[model samples]
Target: MFICSLFFIYIGEQLDVEKNLKKTAVLVGNAVFYVPSIIKMTTIGGIYLLAILLPSFLAGYRDYTIGTDVLVYGNIWFHNAILSNNFWNYLEWANNSSIGVLYATFNYVVSRFTSNVHIFYFWYSFVETALVLMTLRKNRIDIVLGMSTYYFLFFNLTLNILRQSLAMIVIVWGFNYVTEKKLWKYLLIILIASGFHSTAMIAIIIYPLYWIANNREKLLNVFVLSVCILFIVFSEKLTVLALNIGMLNERYSDYLMNSNIRGGFFAHLLFCLPILILYLTAKNNIGGSRDSQRYNGFRLIVAFTTVLSGFNLKYVYLGRVTQYFDFLFLLAVPYIGNRYYVKIGRYRDTLVTKLLIYIYLITYWIIIYGVQNSGETVPYILNFN
Candidate 1:
């Protein structure tokens, strides 16, 4: 799996360069452009081969977090009689209240067929990975760096948020529909995903915002400032309403009120400063007016949401909102790395960029592993193992 992942990453990077080269060649009316286009076509074939092999690799990897969550869901379903009442209740509160129904359902279907829940996790991981890869492919991103970034966000740490991960798939599906101007498909997917997790319903509002805000690059900074202030002043009230309206677990009420996961007040400011610097530096350097405008707009949104995540712990949910923007950066980073660092200078200049990437990877890994290894819960399957 790791080897295949590396191969896909290489193909994606090569194709990215080739695609750009083709666009440049078209502008210059040069026959030399054919070389890059041909290389891109070859890379496409390599990508397809890697995609074919990904499933086998993912299937062999253990999803430790999903295994633990499944066990927690099973125990809640079986141990608590309230959750076993009916299918609706099973869907709504089984993981929190009743373990029997959840256990029975899984045992009758998922567990009964598989050797253990880890296998189920593996399958889910594979499907999620495939869905993300398809989404990126559709977006015309085929590079290894792009795939790595997508995998890190969607399959790595996100495995802990099973419902949210599924919601993300629906959200991306909705994004495609919106981009294609397919209203019905977009709404349908959003609604279906909302049924699985109520938080997804928020996308109904966010989608419209996404549409309206698509071209509004300057407004992103304003929106970020506004959301920060609104959350800061009304956080308690918002938490109360969220709990009352059943958007948040009641147990989290106190945590929301008293906990201080706010990181640092200036943390977001610090992060945004670099992006702001990049934007200023690249504003004139970028080619293609339309593409530059789109990138600027997208970067603003990403910067806004990332800053908001640090302003308040409750805005942790807004992490999903920032993820869409983070994806843009993930793609841009490698291109930028290649352009300014790798191409203009020695490959050694790319070392800093690579170190920054590894730093992010390691930091996220620590956060995820810390949460998973806290030992508050254990998967039933692993217990047997």
Candidate 2:
């Protein structure tokens, strides 16, 4: 956390957007001259540019902190023997119980290295962050606004949420496949992703709804209402099904009926209000009439996640599931912000033009400083120190 702060300060001082953007162009599909054609949110491309670069380089360096998942997963390495005869025993333990096969297998395979835990953490953070950054940019979410939310809100999560973080990465790409109308590709990807975390199957559940959102805008209002009702009614059954399938941790069984898991209360508030405002705005402005299927896809994802947030308010584990889907907010916020920006004019440098940046900063503070689980990052330190 400390080191990250300094890095941010250094970034604030030394980072030059215009120069670095051109420098990083080849890395970002080499769209240098095609800026006007490619851009959707702000013309600046600052946020998308940062998302593309920041996590791949910096995420692996963070030290563990209080309330962080790192302390738990990192220690798993020290507990497991490298190539021990008992390795299969550990596999049996995970497989027979609730741990998804891929995560368990991933841990065992990576643990072959002496420093597998740190390596695991690093590679996981790198791949997860990179996938999301590329997805946002590919989907044409305003790079600047989307990336701002990525840093403030979602970045720390890649440091934690060890398993679902991977699943989130898969679904972000799955959205691109969804937009492209590649049916088999979408199904195959989401199924494989579920192996990392069972909650990812929620992607499958919401996939049909995504079609409804994009193809039938007139049905959108009804579909949106149905999603809300369907989720509230079936979320528990879905939770039970995931438990039975071992997609979720069996340890969370108590939370199924437990009322104490008032998780994501504030987070839900943060996600829902903006989503409602945006949904209404989309409905009123473009509504079903808008021609951009990408925008429709964006709206569907946000709405799906927003309804999931309501379920999250009921239970923390449910909220965790909601979170994997809710990451669409990173893309959706910028879309909405860009829509607003378009009303006034295209993405601009004016403070009023970039208000989403400010909102993201405030959200960043709330998550990092306010939430117990969220404030999990510590200064960067090699695992051995």
Candidate 3:
């Protein structure tokens, strides 16, 4: 925890280096000794490297006890693949078990050279972190803020739902394809991602979501409402369809099959209320902004999330599918705090709004990591022994 604290501090300091360069120069006048580290920390190359590597180091060297899945599933899967008599047997097992082909193939290939699961974890962490940062970079987003948000929210996802995490990041990176209307390219990427986690195929909706967003603004409202209504009405049919298509997988189906149809409608709506409010407030003002297209695209994702949350009333396990879209809040929160209009929201992009946003994010972080321990990533233990 102390190490993670320092890491965040370092990242936080570097975030405003470009903006505060003059102030930094005045404070450190004639301090030649501090120049190199300061310059390195502020540069794109430097932040990119540090952000990816440091988290990879922390997540990779962690004990299996940190995430429940590490002990219960990831370790077992890794050892089983590596210890198999032959590659064919391993492939047979993976096929029978419904493990994603790409995920299984990754394990098999890595096991060929080294059976050390930590090494496997390190590389996995590196690739996943790199892809996420790369997406932020490609979109010209504030990488430091994006990475910080990811650390607080989705980083633990890499540890718990390894395959789905990989697939999710790939889909995140492919957002550009959707915005560009590159149907084939986007579908190709989705296909590859689906090879990692079948549920990733559900992200194909982003294309149409963006299309709907481009239509009359009121159309988005109507379409989203309709989706929620349709999903609720057909919730059971949809679940059965998902199971039939092998989207839910056997392990999940075994438990969810017997689970009650507890309406989580209010719970999800409450959880998403903040972002939904932010989106509607920012909507009227963003038409003239440079990032308007990006914002609108993301707005559709928000609407989709709303539809999914609404459907959560009938089928609780449908919540799992929402994981792919929930990350929009990490980017949206900062965007609203910084760019949301004063006329509409009355926040004026002031420090007060920023402060409130951070407080909200931090509160969620504490609730997830400290209180609920959703991913079982608490009392952070290193694999030092």
Predicted structure with the largest TM-score when compared to the true one: 3
lDDT values for all models: 0.48, 0.58, 0.67
Higher-ranked by lDDT: 1 or 3: 3
Candidate scoring better on TM-score of 2 and 3: 3
Query: What tens digits encode model 1's per-residue C-alpha lDDT throughout 271-376?
Result: 3445444444432323675444445444554555555556435453343344443434544443433332222343345445445554554454344334433222
The local lDDT score (0 to 100) that residue 136 gets in candidate 1 is: 58
Better of 2 and 3 by lDDT: 3
In candidate 2 the C-alpha lDDT for residue 354 amounts to 47
Q: For residues 1-385, what per-residue lDDT tens digits would candidate 3 score against the true structure?
A: 3245336545544654554443333234655332444564455365456656788888778998876567766788889877886887887788667678788888888888888888778788888888877786676665555666677667765677788889988888887888788999999999999888876866776677677766677867587657644654454566678778876555756533331211245545644666666667643434463477667767667767876776676666666667667755556555665555434255454355456555655666676566756666777888944
TM-scores for every candidate against the unseen true structure: 0.60, 0.70, 0.79
Model 3 misplaced stretches (Cα beyond 4 Å): 1-29, 32-47, 85-89, 217-249, 255-267, 283-290, 341-347, 350-352
Give the candidate order by descending TM-score.
Answer: 3, 2, 1
Give the RMSD in angstroms, all C-alphas superposed, for model 3.
Answer: 4.7
Candidate 2: pairs in clash: 1-378, 1-379, 47-144, 48-143
Worst 10 residues of 2 by lDDT: 35-44
> How does model 3 score by TM-score?
0.79
